[model samples]
Target: MSLSGKEGGCDCGAVRFRIEAEPVVVNCCHCRQCQRQTGTAFAVNILVKPDAITVLQGDPAPHEHPTPSGAGQTNFRCSDCGTSVWSIYHAAGDGLRFVRAGALDDPHAVTPQVHIHTTDKVDWVAIPDDMPSYEGFYPGREIPAIMGEDNAKRFARAVGRG
Candidate 1:
């Protein structure tokens, strides 16, 4: 699962990223924010170490939002494209970094291990086969792919542990 040289970019190609290692916590998020931001039912996010994830092009900015849980989560975005390339969450004194899953050049390399925020998930959306489910958010992807620690804390916080 070591990505080593995998690369991905934003929709307009204004922003690009390089993953030096395999992602740890890659999953499809069905939260309302994800649906609104991606303009789709869900968003795929790849969690990797900040050190492992390198933005190859223009620097992205963090768009901060107060989640329903009240913890602060920052979506790292491309200033020009306004694409939420990544997100960082700081909660309980922890940090996690999450990359937009679809942003990867080879998205097939990773798959979501579970579904979260089922309560807010759209009624028409159906869960996948064999993937685990959580009524809310899982504390830590607790796997290799949940990249930036800051982002994980934010995710956990967003799920109400912040």
Candidate 2:
């Protein structure tokens, strides 16, 4: 919590949040779960410390799902606008949190450090080789380690490898 960053709110401005610490990783997930939730080919996320994230305005409605990754993660959304705002996975450590990238005041400032769950990526989308890709949900372990083992499960779903 040594650093402080700009803060912003949800679409309706009813729910607000601030990230007091620098983010650990910025992500663009192409997982089916994320696609379904976002209704888009990919979803952007910013992983930060749970303690560093504070709700400055209102409470967010949460949607919990028992993911196959073996970690119990719940997605927090803005109830007023049905916008996914953040996610908290118990396995990631009590201090970790994942914020929706679009909610940032300067969304463009944050870029994807990794492209996760690429196996489920939409057929029409293109992936840049410069970034990392994964098949399964990255274990909520340390971000750096999780980002690399993507090598273990690198099959592309578009080709039907599973």
Candidate 3:
């Protein structure tokens, strides 16, 4: 489905944004770093091409933090409310963005296509039986199957793999 024109903002409404295109994929990450960063059991991130999102209002500040890859990640948060809206992993450079799904005006508009880093998930957390759960990152070879042919091509192009 086309997710174009979907709007969202920070908690304080200082930063507003619009999605200009359909997302490549949605990932529910259960890694310890994801839990600690979000202060939750898991983090739902909407993956899209860098240009897919457009800022409608306000400027979000970027904050860099450590990552397993040592290349680090940059999280963009509202300057006013300090609500993280999205992130750019150094590994992906400027190719892709990991938008916080919870920051969307209609968070439920998207659902996790895959669950990653499940090995570090909290004991009380349970993934649905039908969801694709991975102990670590999902295999690159499985992208086509999980994201469909079109989205997989988009993803590959976004990450410069195509």
Q: Give the Cα error of residue 136 in candidate 2, in Å.
A: 2.9
Model 2 ranges off by over 4 Å = 1-4, 137-162
lDDT of each: 0.71, 0.70, 0.90
* Number of the candidate with higher TM-score, 1 or 3: 3
Worst 10 residues of 1 by lDDT: 139-148
Q: Specify the poorest-scoring 10-residue window by lDDT in model 3.
A: 1-10
* Native-to-model Cα distance after best TM-score fit, residue 101 in candidate 1, in Å: 1.0
In lDDT terms, how accurate is model 3? 0.90
Q: Is candidate 1 or candidate 3 better by lDDT?
A: 3
Query: What is the clash count for each candidate, in the order shown?
Result: 24, 1, 0
TM-scores of the models, in the order given? 0.78, 0.77, 0.95
Q: After TM-score superposition, what is the CA distance of residue 87 in candidate 1 from its true location, in Å? A: 0.3
